[model samples]
Structures are given as structure tokens and as C-alpha cells.
Target: MTNTNSTKTIAVYGATGHTGGYLLAELRRRELTPVLVGRDADRLRTAATAADLADADIRVASLDDHDALVAAFRDADVVISSLPAYVDHGEAVLSAAIDADAHYTDLSGEQLFVRRVFEDYSARAEAAGITLVPAVTDSNLPGDLLGHLTSRRVDGAAEITISHHSRSGGDGSRGSAETVLASVDWFREGGWHYADSGWQTGRPPVAELRYPTEQPRPASKFPLTPVLTIPRHSAVSSVTGLLPTEFHEGLKKLTADVVAALPATPDPASDLHYDLVVDAEGSGKSVRGVLSGLDSYRDSALMAVEAAVRLAENTTKPGALAAAEAFDATDFLDALAPHGITWRIEEL
Candidate 1:
């Protein structure tokens, strides 16, 4: 929480991954220097070349190595982690950030990891006075937007649903696939218990939803970070989310079709796209906000990088916080519009 007005160095872990590459590029575009970090020196070199950041400093560190991780964060003003969510490495990373007394942020959308960090790590972050922000990407951004709308309209929302759809050309990362599987396991284990005694196994199937102008489309239950975040922000009692069956089915088909598609392999170009539709029902009326875009996975990575830059620059809040709480939803969304994301609000 040392808020000094000066240019600061930021370190990016998993700098070779799909989102990591985009983040590294964004950092360069903003004229901010970022230290690329990963376990593999060769992959780090490849990423540096791909991002045209060959001159940027690079560090090699494994998450299991505490000394290495701490050394990686040394002298850095902020650290952005694009690592896999299920690894549950936030605790260790937070500890390193604390030891280094540097600001920390991540792009994790996993519910269990998020809960653990909020409950167990918040105090340490608060004590260090360093900002530990998580789920700053796809997980909580939609919820933040919905909360902002509800805050202004305050008749109190009854329910909110967020849906995602992808366009024809984009990419997927192995980290994203693993995250999806972990989320499925999370729901299947009766992890999401709503309203006391509402526990159930297996996620619900996508149901048909009617939009203002578009034809009815199927939206299936998808695990999103916002399910845990929106409750902390608005009077809304329930939050539900879905991933387009098109994407899910496509992944399923790919798994069965490609013999080389190992669970550990990265699919950086899966031709994926995504959109989010938030329906707020309150005040005896309902309205919907739709956010559609190409290259959602890449966009999420860019958003995380921007957020880390903002944190390092003292443009956002200090202390441990979630994505929805740390940044203004409208401002963030507006920033992305220039990147080819279409955000629209319609009355229903």
C-alpha cells in the first residue's frame, strides 16, 4: 500500500499462456514495463518474441518454489497472475506479495479459490495495506455492471442471469479448459448451495431465453465468479449464469474428435467467441444489458493486465478486493469498447 507517484515495474506470471501473451502486449502498448515470468525459459522466450517484448526482462519461477516466487516479485510494484485457477495457488502467491509488500491481482474465476482467498488472505492483505484483487476478468465484470444498474434503480432486483456467446474466430487456452472442468466438478459436488438448503448435484441445462429483438435461444447453467460476487454488491437475491451450448458442445466434440487433444495441451485458437446478457427483474419491470464480443479469452487477459496497470498506477483502490469492488464497471466496459466489444442496454 505504498502509494508513491512514480512509474512502477509489474511482473506477469504465466506470461507464455494465451491470455498472458495478450496481457504482455497490452502492458507494452501502455508504455509500461512488465517482467515476463514462467517456469520454462524456452516458453518465456517464445512469448517474449511473440509479444515483440524481447527487450523486456524475463524471470523463471515455479509456483512450488517459494523463494523463486518471492524473488520474482521483488522490486516489482504489482504482480499479475494468469495461472490456472484450480491449482489453488492464491494463498502462496498472496504470501509472496505480502513478503514483497507489492500490490497483487489475478484473473481467477474459480469459486473455491476465491472464497479461500477472501476468508483467509484478506486480513494479511489489509494488514500489509496492499491491494489483492482477484476475479478481475470475466468472472465478476458482468456482476459489477449489473450491480451498478441495480444501485441506480434500487427497487431491488429479484433475479439476474448472465449468458455468454462467442463469435466465429477466437482462441482457447489449456488453462481455460482446465478451469471449465474444475468448475463442472465444483457444481457436481453440490458446491453451490443457494438460499440455505438449496444444494443440488449437476448443473442445470440451458433453458430457452427470449431477448428483446433476437429469437429465443438456449442458455445452460455455467459457473461464473459473479455467482459469488454479485451477492456481495447488490440487493439482488439470486444470480445465475450460463455458457452457450454451442461452445460447450464444441469442446465436448473436440475432446472426442482429436486424439491429440490431451487434457494438459493448450488450444490457443479454438475459434471461440463470447457474450454476456444480464437480465435484471425488479420494480415490476425488467431490463437487459448485453455484452458481446470476439476473442473473449484474449479480452479477459487484456482486462486483467489493464487492471494490474491501474492498480500499480494508483488509479484503483488499495487493499484486498474483488474485481467488482475495485473498479467501476462502466469505466472498464467503456475501455473495452474500443477493443471491439459491443455493449448494449435494452428495456424489456
Candidate 2:
């Protein structure tokens, strides 16, 4: 089921935003031209021009413009979405993809939205014969891949913990900030975690964690998309995702003013380093693994593009799927070798 054509046309729904620009640039770097779709024609033009994609095709369509949106994706092989607050905009674009019979992927980190995609749209996508993969970015996939890798080494892996650490100091991308703000109530209400053979609620807030380089920090239990993703393939009885206490508190206190004050662009000179440590324990033994990467946003862009390319080339089952479930863990990480992402499993 490989794509016989030399290039596959990918439609990017939010191709004018910051991360969308990276996706466009990555597509161009790989010589796969993209159809730029966004609400602002001028912003799309400006982004394409800045990315040196002056000749790329551009499509202007709002999410509400279902006819135009469907038309934009009609000729494409896949659609990669960078839209934020996905709970609001995701369904429309996903519906467009299904209507167009195109494979779909996105960078959504919202847990509820992820679950909805699987529950509500999986049957439709399967019937349409198109794959739908949500949470295809760094926020979830890296830890997901590590957890799967760790679980593969430990038989009857009953518990898995994913811890995140980053090197940068300021707020993350604007899309991320907006998503966090949109889901503030969910975060405060204590998000869901997988435990006790089913979804659990109201878990403890924080726990002590020893990172690879830093001392012990009070990591807060943040129910990221991994809680839904990891359990899709692994037989882990429980999964917990945590963020640094400082980062988690800052996210809780994020105001519109703070989001507005965040830099319009990331500091290029200041490298963003992300580390994920996954501990899978069961059957009286344990296995641990670590994954480290630079530039979470750019890595996600690369990941989205790579996943699109692979879907266009390989035979992918049609259904709602997680990143690790959709792609081979080791092969996917190896494909990211050129981007300076590394991982390893350790015996314990």
C-alpha cells in the first residue's frame, strides 16, 4: 500500500501559526509540498513566504466553512492539524478528513478530546477506511513510546509512571498555553488516570521524583494524553503522568495576561531539552527507559510530518489510534534519528 507517487499532498489546517510554520518548513524540507489552509489568507501567505514556500498552494477556509474545508482536503492524501483548543475545532476538521477519505493526525494533548475521538469517531473513521490519530506530538508520543518500550521488557507490567523534565524556563508555545487555559476547569477538577482495572479519579496531586540530572522535585500528577494513549497497547494496570511542580503550578496560575506576555517566538539560541523517564514494574521485576529530545515543538512538527508520510506509504488500519499504537515504537524513534531524539531501555 505504498504511495506510488513521488510526493504526497498533505493539507495543513493551521498552516499560518508558529508550529504550523515549522510543519510547513518540514514538509518542504522533505520535498512534500503542503496545501496551506487557514482562516487568514494574509497570514497564510506571510507564513508561506517566510518559510520560503512562496509557490506552495494555499487554501483559505474557516472551520465553520465545512464545504470549503472539505474542498481544501479533497485532493490531499493526509491532513496534519496544529489547531489548539481541539475540543472546539477538532471535530469539524476530522469530519472533513473523513469526508475526503484522507488520513488524519493532530497535536492535541487534551485527554477528554482524545477520548471523544476514539469513542465517537472511531467507527466512522473505520467505515470510511481512513486512519484517525490524535495526540501525534511531543507532549504525548515520546512518553508513550518510552512506556511501550519499557513495558515490552517487563512481563506483566502492572504499573507505569511517566515523568517529564524540561530545560527551558519561560512559558511554552501559545497553542499549548491556550489549550491549557481552555481546559483549566478539567485540570483543577483533577483529571482522570488509569488504575484499578478502569478509569480512576481524584488521585493525589504531587509526588517526589528524581530526574536524570536534577535533584528531587515535587512532580504534580498531570493527566496528559498519555493516560489514554499508553494503555491502548500496553497491559499496564495503572499509568501516571507528572510534570515538574514549578511548571504545573505555573500552568495552574496562567492568566490571559501571562499568555499575552509570552514571547511571540521561541528563543532559537536557547535549546529546549525534554526528558521522559518511564518505569514499568510488574511480576516481581522492573524495567526503565529514558527518552531525551531537543525542541519539543519542532520535534512534534517532524513527528506529525513523518507520521503523515508513513501513513501515505504504509498499510495503516482505519480507526482511532494512538501514536505508539499507529507506528512501530523503535522504528518511529529511529526515523527521528536525524532530529537528535534518543532513547534507551535499562535493566533494574
Candidate 3:
């Protein structure tokens, strides 16, 4: 890890988006200057100003413009990409990070994209001695924390399940909406599944467990954090993911209506608060952890920011990584405690 006083700079791509806005604020709060990069000049300027980072430089570039992206990354000690998970754009961002020879991190959950990077970019990043961490936010962090907690009790875990719940109030950002839509299309095509080969189709529902709550919400299958994290962690043989079936059905209903009313602005009435519960089981016993909070997008940005700052300070290893592999899991979770994000654990 590098010293805080080194005056090194970090660049944030997609700086004009909602999560990017919060990320910029976090950087400013830490007295770190972050270069804001986005396709929209006006929005970038506005976001930079809003973060009280008027002195920070704003660069205009899109994923299609390879040269501009490379230029934007040049000289950056670290590059934090809050870019939405568009298949094409995601690859371009990774290319830019490689071109710049800077450490890279992003909030992405696209399984295909993640696999490509792991297979293709991992060696490149290692050769450059720069880190490339994907799924740095909500998708993977909670499960990683759960894995860490479970390891203390058992030698290995056989299966794990993760579930998410959010209040229906806050609106999704443009980026989030796009990512969700893409994921929906992917799932519709049976693009994700678990198999003996790992994350393949034809695997049946792992299990249906009731969330330990007064409401006893039922969870449905979803592809997000666990699909990627479980395979990465050798302690676990397999992982399955779920979301409240009611929440999934509710979202499906809203998406149907929204699709019918295309070209019109999305209705914000369906937004809500969110929560997550993760359970891990092994040969002898099991452990469960719950993390409940508000504003999923904001929380994700906060997580990314804290992790990015830690990366900039060289508080973690310098090579290809993920949230659990790069940052100190316990320290990261402890930091979130002051932000109204609480985690409770139990042994069963």
C-alpha cells in the first residue's frame, strides 16, 4: 500500500451517473482528488461541481472512442469504473484500463463479462503488476463477508444461498435500469445456471429457505453475486442465489407495464428500500448473516468508493482481484457499520 500523502490521482469513469455522483463525493470527503470522466461534458462538470471538486479535471469520452478512453486513463494511479454493465462497453473499459497500465475496479455482475476478464485480463494485469477487481459492490461483497465468517466455524462449505430485499421507494438510475434490463434478457435466454461444470444450465432449484423474519418472505432464484463469488472462493463447492419471490414478481409486473409504456419516462412509484440475507452451510453446522439497508445504488457507490480509496492508499494487494480478495473483508464490513449498514450473524 502506498502512503496517503503521495498525491496520487484516481480517475472515475461514468462520473455523471447517480452512483458515480456518490463516488465522487466520497473521494472528495477523503481529501482525494478524482478526475471525472464521462461522455456528457455538462453532466460531468455538474457532477464534479456538486461534489465540491471544481478543481478536479473533467474528461469527455465514450467507450467507443478507444483513444480518448486511453487518454483519460493515462497517468491515473487507479481507475474506478462505475460504468453500467453493457456487454460491449464493459470490454472497452477493461481495454482502457489495460492500455493505461493502471489498477482497475468496477461494479459489474455480468457473468460472461466477468469470465472473459478473468481468463483474458488476469494474466495481463499480473504481468503489469496492476490490480483488476470486478464485482466490487453489492453483488459480491456480502457473500464474501459471509464466506469469511463461515470459514471460522467449518473447514469447508458445501453450499451457500444469498437473498436480497429492498424497500419500494427510491428510483433506479439510468445505468441501473439498463443493467437490470440486460440481465433480464440474459436470464430469459437461460444465459446463467449452475452445473457440475460450474455456473451452467440444468441445475435445479438449490433450496427454498425462509428468511428469519416476522414476515417469512419466500426467496426466488436470481443471478448476481453468488454466481461469480462462489466459484472464485475455493472454500465453497457451490453457491445458489435468491431474491424474495414477491419482490421478483412485483418487479416483473412493473417491468411489463413499463415495457408497454415504452418511450415514456419510467414511473418512480415502484422504488423501495432493500436488504440481503446470506447463509452458508458445511458438514457439521451452518452460519447466516443479514445486511439490511436503504438506497441500493447509493450503498453500492459507497462500497465502491471505500474500496477504491483503500486501493489508492495501497491498503490491499497489487494484482488481479475481487472485493473479497483485494480488501480486508472484516475492515470493509466494519467501515460500513458507521453508514447505517448493519450485519448480524447466527450459528445453526
Off by over 4 Å in 3: 1-5, 169-171, 189-197, 206-209, 247-272
* Cα lDDT tens digits for candidate 1, 64-139: 8888888888878888878775446656776787777788888887777877777778787777767887776653
What's model 2's TM-score?
A: 0.94
Writing each residue's lDDT as its tens digit, candidate 2 over 144-236 gives 888888887877856888876777753577777777778877765557888876777676545687678678887777777888878888889
What would the per-residue lDDT of candidate 3 be over residues 110-133, giving only the tens digit for each residue?
A: 666777777788888777767887
Model 2 clash pairs are none
* TM-score, candidate number 1: 0.84
Instruction: List CA RMSD, all candidates.
Output: 3.6, 2.0, 3.3
- Stretches off by above 4 angstroms in model 1 are 1-5, 168-171, 187-206, 211-214, 245-271, 315-317
Question: What shift in Å separates residue 143 of candidate 3 from its native position after superposition?
Answer: 2.0
What's the TM-score of every candidate structure? 0.84, 0.94, 0.87
Q: Higher lDDT: candidate 1 or 2?
A: 2
Worst 10 residues of 1 by lDDT: 192-201
A best-first ranking of the candidates according to their TM-score comes to 2, 3, 1
- Which ten-residue region of model 2 has the weakest summed lDDT? 1-10
